[model samples]
Target: MKRLLSALLATAVLAGASLTARAETVDITMAAGHPPVFRWVKHANQTFIPAVNKALEGSGITVNWSEQYGGSIAKVGGVLEAVEEGLAEVGLVSSLFEAAKLAPQNVTYFTPFVSSNATAISELMDRLHEENAELRKSWEENNLEYLGAAIGIDDYLLMTTFPVNSLDDLKGKKIGAPGPAVNWLKGTGAIGVSGNLTTYYNEISTGVYDGVIVFATAAVPGKLYEVAPYVTKVGFGAQYAGGIAANKEWFDAQPEALQNALRRGGVAQREAYHKDLDQAITASLEAIRANGGTVTEVSPEFRMKWAAGMENVAKAWAAQLDGEGKPGSSVLSAYMDAMRKDGATPVRDWDKE
Candidate 1:
């Protein structure tokens, strides 16, 4: 009987130790410049956070998440800085805002008219980060560890107060575009005004701009239809706006098991982001059309003409990077090559030019 009691006591003590070990928690703060309204933010909250928590379940480690979003911890365009400075252990870094800082990483932005598949674009971007050295360098230079990409908008669209039937409709018009995208307006005869989603509505409403080069996903919630209800589907191609990034020091400090959990969660988040983006693009465009808005699909011929008319921004973009010895040309060539291999026939091969 005494031996039985001793055995039971030992079992209870071991169980307590195991429970205590499993209760260990690691606290991490994740931040995003944009609010939780968009698909990227939504997936981060509903999918990614839950995914990580689930991955670590019964692994003797748990994460305490501090989610800061919607310009709460950092304003839009400042996520990279916040993460680099370790203000947030992880963040969603916007390449759109980091054009100058992450030039090579913005290959999708420079070479448009290639893809409209959000899933393909997101997966390709993640694969490129894994395979491309220069792409990896961009993150390392900024003291970030790339996890997976979060592509918000599916394809670029043009919204204007006036209906657009042809390229001539854009002549002498002042159209707003986000950073670096202003180059897309070159040779279109329309003056490109540097603008962001935040100011697109007010700018158009106040006559600060006549139209905007934007996306359907953003346009619907932005209530841009009230100001610029004319939506033109130009097939400007889906883009990589931002992605998950971690402070290098912080990431390296994590245990291997924790690192694996984060990586798994990041990939899951990317997939969720693309699926949601695909759904959002459809729903948002439908919402716009239902609200007395006009949706027009630009002809393939017109798209080709537009692509040809634009300043060989791709060539110049790559050359500028080549001059800086930043692997710009190589990334350009490789990206276009990959797209072609994936059965994409771009209106203009930005790299070959």
Candidate 2:
């Protein structure tokens, strides 16, 4: 009896040790510049957080999430610094704003008229980052671990108070475009004002600009149609806006289980985000029409002419990166090549030019 009691006590102690070893709870903070109303931010909450939690199940690890969005923790173009400085453990870092730091990630923006499939662009970009050391280095240099969940914007549209049947219609017009995208207006005789979604509606409403280069998924929510009622589907091609990333230092210190969960969450989030975006694009256009906005699509010939007439921005962008000792030309070429390989016939081969 004494021997049996001693054995039972030893077994109890071992079980306690096992439980202690497996028990872990990690606290993480996720942030974004945009509010949860935005698709990217919405996915972070609905898709990413839940996916991470699901991945962590049965690992004896649970995550406590603190979400800070809508410029609560950081404003636009500041999310990278916020994560890097450890203000937030994770962030939706907008490469659109970090053009200088994340130059390589802006390949899609420079080469328009290639493809407008947001899901494909997101998948391609995520794969490129995984395959290219130079691309990965950009994030690493910024003290970030670039996860998946590439934030892709759908085909760009021109929203204006006036109609745009041809480039002539835009002459002398003050058009607002997001970063890097402003270059898209070059040679069109239109004045380009650098702006973002947060400012586009107000800017257009007050005559700060006549119209904006925006996407449908975002336009509906922004109620931009109310301000600029004409929507022209210019098909400037989908853009890889930004991505979800973690503070490298913080991420590196996490246990393997937690790290894997984060990565898996990123994958799930990317899939979910594009899925949501596809639906939103269709719904947004319908919403725009329902709310008294005019929707028009440019003729394919006009689209081709518009693309062809633009200055070789891709070449200049690549050259600028090359001067900076980054793989600008290679990335540009690789991106175009990948698009072509995937059966996309670009209106203009920006790289080849």
Candidate 3:
């Protein structure tokens, strides 16, 4: 009778252990390079995170977000590495900033004057990711999984101390441009200064640059009006969708249902981002004007000149990619074709055929 009781007790302990294991929870952490006050963070907090949590409400998996904005965990340029090293389970990566790391993806940004419409640009990026396996593999090799992409503000404009009515007006001026945007500043004779959206405010105020290449939405929030108050919408073209990527290892460890929830969150975040951007553009313009800034719409003639000047950057970028053994030329051609199909007439041939 005692022996039988021992056996039953052992079985009960085993059952309890199994139950504990089944009740274990999965947790995830996400990081963004922008500050909490920035639109990226605002949207994530107000829209993205809540939507994701709601999607995963009964999934038994919990996501704990760690917002390391303003260069806390990773600087704007270091976000890719941050995720690769597992500093955070997921992160916001600016393809425009990490052009070399995300080559084919950044092509959309290199080719300026392609399309200023946010919707078209977002669709193009999503299609590019879906159609190209290699592009997806690039993220995998870096220990990350690309979830969803979100478009930044519309094409960049020149925010300067002086009014820029023509391409000639940019001559000899020092303009702060992010990595790919430097290519857009070529032939205008403007001295291109490497800068990021994070540093633009202080740099502009300290006279580190005469102006900055930025979008109206960012300018208003960054309070760029106090420094370079003249806003010029030069129709430079829209930026490709930035992405939310996760550490592949961390992602794989999650339950299948939890993984699906994160993806659904990504989709919701992308839609919310675009919608917010559209609304922010109008509000930003008004806010900038209200804050004592000047906004100007560049003429079509000047827009054409600006577009023509930056045409060769696309070819140069393609060659740079070819040298890297990636399908840069092919990607550029495909993207140009897609853009044209979407009603964007290219100012220059991407293939030169």
In TM-score terms, candidate 3 sits at: 0.91
**Candidate 2 on 176-285: residue-level lDDT in tens?**
99999999898888999999998888899899999999999999889999999999998899989989999999999888988999999999999998888888888999
- Expressed as tens digits, the lDDT of each residue in 1-353 for candidate 1 is 99999999999999998866655788789998877876788788998889988888878788889999988989878899999999999888888888877888788888889888767777877898899878989889989998885564588999999999999999999999888888889988999998888778899999999999999988887899999999999989888786899999889988787888888889999988777777777899899999989999999999999998888888898899989879888898888888889888888888876
Which tens-of-lDDT digit does each residue in 1-353 have in candidate 3? 99999999999999998865654454456677788777766777777777878887776656666666667888887888999999988788877778768878887777777777876778677767877887887788889888875555577788999988777788999999988788888888999998888899888888889999988888887889999989998887778747888899888877787778777777787788888888888888899999999989988887777777664877878898899888788888888888888899655555563
Best by TM-score: 2
Estimate the TM-score of every prediction: 0.92, 0.93, 0.91
On lDDT, the leading prediction is 2
Candidate 2, residue 341: Cα displacement in angstroms equals 0.4
Q: How high a TM-score does candidate 1 get?
A: 0.92
List runs of model 1 lying over 4 Å from the truth. 1-23
lDDT winner, 1 or 2: 2
Q: Estimate candidate 2's alpha-carbon lDDT, on a 0 to 1 scale.
A: 0.92
Candidate scoring better on TM-score of 2 and 3? 2
Query: How well does candidate 3 score on lDDT at residue 87?
Result: 90
Lowest lDDT sum, 10 consecutive residues, model 3, at 20-29
